[model samples]
Target: MFKTNETQMQIHSIRWLKVIDPDQEYITHISTQFSIPRNFIQTALDENASARIQCKQQATLIMTHLPFNTSSKAEQSVSCKSFAVIIKDHLVFIISKHDHPIFDQMIQYVEQGPEHSAEQLADYVYRFLELAADQFIVASKSVNEQISTVEHELLSSIKNKQVFKLLNHNKVLNRIAISLRGNSKVLNLLNDMQVVTGHQAAQHRLLNVMVETDQAQAMAEIHNINLSNLMDAYSAAIENNLSLLVQYLSVYVIIAAIPLGIASLYGMNIPLPLQEQPYALSLLAGLSLLLSVAIVIIFKKRQII
Candidate 1:
């Protein structure tokens, strides 16, 4: 039931099976054809699956989350998807829900020819891990740019939408961080298992994979910290702005009450100061204006306005 686009390659007498976005029927076929434990395959294809390695008598399964889609469109958020590689004797199966570009590179690597060994197979796995780490790095950079854009917008003027965008960006960064940590754990487990044993070159490549994974993890953490701080500062700023607004409104209310009080007194039928003066209304108006101006000037001098 495999599609034509799916590939099964024979390299140096070793069979390589690569499936892309397999369905239930395809999974059934793979399970029946290869006798692989169904859970091994399912775990790899599960969207929310974390990085893991499971060893059984029949097969060794290595699964890690990779950047699923890295479209540069501003509206699209970064995400990771599971990619699993299973090795049983001379047979290797690579499974993923999305046909990542790294798979293409692996196909080329397979075609280029190399002596097949556990190290070579491990190297194949390493390539998947390496590419995942690299993708995380790219995602971190993209997120940093987005943070900058949001910060710039905030600097010019604060808006509710921009704050919401900050929250969204932080969420993306947290996802990346969590995925990187999972991948790092898997890579460390692989190193401890010595899957590439006795091959110095492969071991070195594995070390690079570990280093890259750690670096990506570190970047994600740093971004998360910076984003957290930014959000805290933004919240503080919003509070400060609100406080200032309330202060200004209070000041204006007090200033307006002066005129209202004067008007109320003049409207009363009871005798008031200077009521019989011909220019009493004009005089009262001038008094209200002078008092309002004085109060405003006092607020300004006290740095309250």
Candidate 2:
């Protein structure tokens, strides 16, 4: 689906074109309409695409991954997806193969008001960038909440299942960290090069985007560190639990060994002092029980059991 929104206020010459899961026909149509390279259109549709920026002629293609809520039945529950914002001539093309909430937010933002064309392109692009950063912040909050929940569950019971879940969360955070960092770098480079220079308002918006990107990068970094630390702490806790279990089994074996030795010695068919006595069987059994009790008491006193 294609959503075309043109500001009637004439504050900006740039019109916004948002595409949702564009098919080949849609890609071809836009490619021909804006003279954008077919490769650019195809790349934007790619889900595995990375964050990047390139300018061709008067058209600039910025392919970046945005943090998204991963509620899909797919294997990955948390990850970033591509969001391409192409500024060509007098229009801005936002492409995505998936219908992302961030894009919906962008759509609402574009349609919410009308501004003069004075610096509409820069304004629109930066606004979308800010929205993307906002998405990252939102995604991180959910991820952190998940991490906290997992941490609580782990504290109650150290299950490897939760470990696997934590691993998935970490993978998600890792992706976010990479995407945020990459996007921030690209935005910083653009700022230094004055890629979106012109109207004071647009420049101010661009500066705001730079700040937003920095904040997003910092957020990603902080969460990644927290997740790493959580993993480390929980991993050690799991190992400690296993070690305690093994210690318990070892103590049990030692206690069992004492009773086994006593039974074996008595079971021997040798002519011993109590072998001729009528109460020899009961006597040996009593001795065995006493020895086992003594061993249990010793272990308990030593706090080894």
The window of 10 residues in a row where model 1 has the poorest summed lDDT is 1-10
The parts of candidate 1 lying over 4 Å away from their true place are 1-17, 69-75, 89-91, 99-101, 105-120, 153-165, 196-199, 260-287
Residue-pair clash count for candidate 2: 5
lDDT of 2 by residue, 1-305 (tens): 54433222122465667776766776787788778888877888787887788877677888887876657674336678887888777777777777676666766676675763635667777878888888888888888888888888887464698888888888887888788888887787677776665667777877887788778778867888888888888989988888888898998888788768877887788866888899988987788788879988998999988
RMSD of 1: 3.9
Which residue pairs show collisions in model 1? none
If scored against the real structure, what TM-score would every candidate get? 0.79, 0.79
User: Candidate 1 on 65-96: residue-level lDDT in tens?
Assistant: 87765556667577777888888877888888
Which residue pairs of candidate 2 clash? 11-115, 11-116, 11-117, 12-116, 12-117
What TM value does model 1 have?
0.79
Give one clash count per candidate, in the order shown. 0, 5
> In model 2, which runs have C-alpha deviations exceeding 4 angstroms?
1-14, 72-76, 114-118, 156-160, 256-290
